[model samples]
Target: MTISSRVRLICLTGALALSVTSLPLSWPNPALALSDIKDITPAPPEQDPPATPAPAPAPGDDEDLSDEAFPVIPDPDPLIKPSNTDESDATTPQEPAPEVIYDLEKAPEPVRRMRQLIMDAAASGDIQALKPLLDVGANQTQVPLQTSDQDPIAALKGLSGDDEGQEILAILLDILSTGFVQLDKGTPDEAYVWPYFAGKSLALLSPRERVELLRIVTAGDVAEMQEQGNYNFFRVGISPDGRWKFFAVGD
Candidate 1:
């Protein structure tokens, strides 16, 4: 080739080398450019900051009420209309007063005679004196003794602490002295029972009635009878016809 053409070709080659050397070593990648674009884009409008959870309720909140917590309501008083013009006038039901008799003169002739006879026998202080009066079979005086014993005198002795039965006689006198009540009036069972307390309720006893009872027995005895709801002491029962119905203890 000619020298001029060779020199021109050499200058062209050196220019191209200098231009390439002046450029940056790292080349811009297409994938890196796309990643940078994604990073810069605004995040989808921040979706209303994920709803915050509601605060918990305080203690005893939203609980059911118990039956015990409610106040008790009492039943209303019964309706009572006033009998008189006065609104405060109220009448309450009361129990009937018991019929009590202290005098023996009010009794029939036969009863009085029989009572006198028994009193005389008891005053004698001899247990045998009562045997004649109690001799009638099936109609004998009903003494507090076992059914196996048929003899009234022996039964009296058994009841007495001593062999002569003076204690039983004393008890008989004490029983006959107390107030009496005539039960089953006009009926076949009509009889005068000594010590009216036997058939009467201890709870309903008046102050005077209690005094009469204390005459024959102690306060402790009345208290015990009150607890038991009945009298449990010796008593005598005589029919209107003067027949001795019973001479026994217990209700």
Candidate 2:
């Protein structure tokens, strides 16, 4: 409460304020200050590097891959696999092949002699020469004519382009020159037909047989006959008993 005591207290307070003001103001070191702060933010999530894309394939690579995945199959052999054409159908009925005989000695004596006589008459180039062989009877030689009652010799003349009937003679010679076939053996219908094609199927001919057919007819003619399924040309037939059965044209 005395003046002197109060003055001393004031002086002591002033000295304390001056000491606080005179002291240097220093900031904390920057690196040490940041380290002092609490790390509240969550650490960034761990991340993987971006993946690289695969390279693209070159041209034709897809085809090469496909070939490796599925191999190609080859076609079957033709000999092993038959075609399904109608001509080769197994269900179709085939004609029985006739026995073609080329050697004249195989024929009976009567048949051989009669054939030779006919050949001689045909080679003579005279239609009338055939009249004697064609007698009027039940066993008489049969010929293609308009009427059954017509005279065989006269009918032949009418058929020929020339009056001498040389064309008919040539046709007879051509028909008898080839091979012959025996049909319906030991039966009343049995006969030896000239130009074996008369009793054989044109479709079933061998290469050599086809050549024989070509000798008597043209390729176009043979093709047409094949379509018709038989030989259609001049033919001569003789019975086993040596009788000249027929000289005709047609199936």
Error (Å) of candidate 1 at residue 85 is 32
Cα-lDDT of candidate 2: 0.85
TM for every model, in the order presented, reads 0.59, 0.60
Candidate 1 weakest lDDT stretch, 10 residues:
81-90
lDDT of 2 by residue, 1-251 (tens): 99999999999999999999998888565575776899899999999998898677787676344656877788767777667766576686766788899999999988898899988998998788898777468777777788988989888888787898898888788778889999888899788999999888777789998988888788999989988999998888888888888887888
Q: What lDDT tens digits, residue by residue, belong to model 1 across residues 123-160?
A: 99997888777736677678867765557788878888
lDDT of 2 at 33: 75
Full-model lDDT, candidate 1: 0.83
